[model samples]
Target: MFLIPAIVLSQRPFLIPHPLLATAAPANASILLSGVLLSLVVIYLASKCGAEFSKRLDFPPVLGELVAGVVVGVSALHLVIFPESGMEASDSVVMTVLQWLNGLTPDALTNVFQSQSEVVSVLAELGVIILLFEIGLESDLRQLKEVGSQAVIVACVGVAVPFTAGTAGLMMLFNVPTIPAIFAGAALTATSIGITSKVLSELGRLKSKEGQIIVGAAIIDDVLGIIVLAVVASLAKTGEIDVTNVIYLIISATAFLIGSILLGSIFNKTFVTAVDKLKTRGNIVIPAFIFAFFMAFLGNAIHLEAILGAFAAGLVLDETDARNELDALVKPIADLLVPIFFVTVGARADLSVLNPALPENRAGLLIAVFLIAIAIVGKVVTGWAVFGQPGINRLAIGVGMIPRGEVGLVFAGIGSASGVLDKPLEAAIIIMVILTTFLAPPFLRVAFGQPEEPPANGEPSLEPAAVVNEA
Candidate 1:
């Protein structure tokens, strides 16, 4: 499995007169595959260990995965370092291992390094698509409908307040540049439905009036957050906001989501018929993914984020008779792919920017402090947005929306990839995500009067948080 470099080196003289060209050819492909496999090994170990430790501590497993990634990433071990961070193949522990094992030439090592990074990045992207799809499945449209206007008010306020307040404060108070400020502000908009829902379930309040409002608003918040992310991510790429592009994204995202859900009945019928006719395995799930990938492709093709399409696909399928079965089938796939997404997000973060010793790093530390304040206070105030609930626990509704969770990480990752966020700013966004995610569960428990320990009955776990790499 690892002899490709040896085979190539031994045959190089006969195959080509130019050593450099020969080294850059198919040799890197073989090594790239090896590097990716080793990277996955490290990623899985970190994810599982981190998740297991976090679970024991009563924290979200996703937090452990992020911290674990930081430990193995450029922030510490340098075991899974990337090329974009100005690191060479020699900087990566994985690459060093491969070199020692295969006796790679310097030229071949560089090629393998770049190729390996690209492939891992692609896998991380796929992991997010799967994560969004699973989120869609969990966002029950029926529940969303039943919850009504109060939830809508809460969700709108949750998105608008933080976005407006965070962006303006960064620009006005901190003198930060516009695009980066917008990206950071956009990161604050997402409320992790998965994490909040899990907490509500654990507290036995998933059926409470307040619980229903929180869940419903969070569902709406996810949709709005994706739209906001799509717009800001596009703007980040261009480094300037184009009004036309923003309007187009907003309209297209809204239209795509509404269109797909509207047509869901017709699609669901065809989907069921196809699944029933197939005697082979993956009958239902296969068709579901084809639709998902197709929607994701359309989203990208239309200049929107691919996740929007994947999300819309999930919503459409959520209405089907096969919803529960599809949810069960999709979980294992999500488990395999989603950790790669979370770990990579964690790995890319450079925590060194948060250090207070350096004069330059203080700005980042302050930004992080500012963002955390905005993240909590902005969402917490959304509780007051709930009108006509007479005696509703408005504080609980707001607290539930506070955790940015996996969804916030998605924003930071995209912003970093777009190169609009400087290291300091990017690190600040990550810190805010981590703090808000960690704080939400306990704050929620207190807000709800610290409900009893979850019952021992084997009732199907309402903790969908575990499914999405959040809780």
Candidate 2:
């Protein structure tokens, strides 16, 4: 039996001798495969580590993932090493082996990794859209009606203050032209509602009065963020911020929003009614995915982020009982896809260009610090925007909004791509991203009075805060 097994193994295709033993081609192919496999392994292991870290630290898992990337990337540890001269020499044979794997069809390896990166990016974009949509779905529009004025005031102030501080800081510190600074500051105006919501939920104050105000303000913040982004993008392309164009963008955005809501409401009724009539078997997920992609595509056609459409779709679903079922279905996919978004953001962050020795680099770092300070302080002040209410801690609500997470990084990416920020500035923006995300959870836990120990007898000890029902 042993002899037969040996013979079978020897005869396998994988065990066959290389026909081109003398060529460099085979060695290169081997190298490429190693890199791809190594990247995958790293991602999986990092995700596991990230989950544990988040639980232990009481922070968002994204912070853990960023740490994981720092370990693998050149920014910190040189775990994923690629040697020059096309010759691999390292203490451990693993680096050599990875180099050999990467050598195999270098072009093919490059193409494969690029495609994989793009796939992850598309999913990440989808995840953001879904996240925003979930927020909209969960939103109480009636609450907005009650505190609309307050929300608008807080959001406007929040956007303006941070933006001005960020722009001025960038311009003075980096000595960059005015246009880029304006764009950079504009990027900082948007609040990442996901991070804010996560912190609020952890604080056991998701239904609090201040929480409601923050949520309302965030919706306005997002709208303003898009407008600023559009204006900046136009300026980047045209080399001047046109007042006429800005006016047009504002009008267009308003129409797009109103149109999306109206159209979404009508489509929601029609589609849900049809689905009810069809009495579909199994899960509604596949159809739902199709519908989501279609709406995302439509949003793109309208010159808006597909996420806007996804958010609209979610709002429509929120009006129906099917929202719960859809959430259940989508949560699994979100779990698998969302981490890729965070990790990819980290992967794309190339910090090597930021040499602290250089004056420009040092200046950029200072600007980053200043802007981050403003970003945090500005939102914290907005907590006071919850007016006509007493006995509520507005500071907690503002603190909850401190983290920028994916959205802020997305804006930084836009600036980098549009030539509004150099590599070092981008690195600085990422630092701010990491800081805000890492800090929020612990602060939230403290603010909300989370007990240090589990309640005895497994009884729920904490009581929900009094609901500040303005509506």
Candidate 3:
């Protein structure tokens, strides 16, 4: 009969409807999208609550963000499961409970978290790119020139001492490889100008010579840090550590930066003119972002990091008539993306590594504690190096530079991505970042001798201080 023939045809492999087709094609896509949205909401809420609590307790908001990450991340409550090959073979008690509760196999759970983390990672990458671009936008060549010699000395000393100390310490004490140790040193070199500026501004010392020196030194430190990152990342990629290779990397990175800036500066006006002819003048952000992405691509082509390209893009645009407009438009995007970066970095921290009962975990904890001490001492030493400002409180300046904040986290994230910083090491790095961020405010307050803020007669004083963004 016709019914029998139809049933036989339907039973064939090709006759079967696809699962998504049976529902809607977007069913899987919707689930992934929903998962990402829900995850962001959760992370944002936790970060806000944590930050508010920290502020109430007189700590930086980043401490709260890290706390939020640990609470939801892989090593703690595991609320945000990560898919790792390790998880497939893991006899982890927590993983078992999660698997059973979710009615999934270990493999399935790993796949799910892998998918989730991938989405988060991409957003986080964007966050760092936007951050560096903003920094480039804010760098006024005149201001840096004004600070001049003193700032240069501080930056050089600050970078050299920490780079040497961190790399040597990690290598000698932890037996870490040359590559990982170098990356750790690079991570230690950043001074969070944004965080330091806030404390100085609150104390009404932002216009002080010490403040100018600190800001100038910090700007220099950023440029140095990025270059160092370039060298280390290059070495890690090449798996070479000789002096010849080292020199080559440094020269290459410096040339790339110089070339990109010069080229961008030369053509920026023409590029803007062309873009202005487009419909995006009403929202120039579109062209602004395109330039950033294009530079990023060029950086990749030149064996430099995309971040440098993004930074170059910002440097070029900073000179344009639309500089302020670009900042205004890009800032909102950065605000949304930057927090996602920090929170995701925090989530990557392996809290299990801090467990005292496990031998390895206890060792990791010791490493974390040691790193905190070194991180503090490393930056504090630079405060004393402000020889030009003999009257400046060396202690205050050093304390001001101590907080690693977002910048340190960015370094750590890159190290991990490059396979130089393992889970235990990254956890240690995160611990250091959190503690330094928390400690700097209180230490800086004491160093500055907590002034009672003068009453504001109008709007707040218009003085140059660190740009304290939510990032």
Query: Which candidate has the top score in lDDT?
Result: 1
TM-score for each of the candidates? 0.79, 0.74, 0.71
Best model number under TM-score: 1
lDDT for each of the candidates? 0.74, 0.58, 0.64
When sorted by lDDT, best at the front, the candidate numbers are 1, 3, 2
How would you order the candidates by TM-score, starting with the best?
1, 2, 3
The runs of at least 3 residues in candidate 2 whose Cα sits more than 4 Å from the true structure, single-residue gaps closed, are 1-41, 77-103, 169-176, 201-209, 262-265, 279-283, 349-360, 410-427, 451-471
Report the C-alpha lDDT of model 3 over 5-106, residue by residue, as the tens digit: 111222222123322212323534444455566678767776777667766776556556666776777666555444431343133333344455556555
Which residue pairs clash within candidate 3?
none
Residues 400-467, candidate 1: write the lDDT tens digits. Answer: 88988656656666677667788778778877887776678778877988554434895654545323
Give candidate 3's TM-score: 0.71
Which run of 10 residues does model 2 get worst, by summed lDDT? 1-10
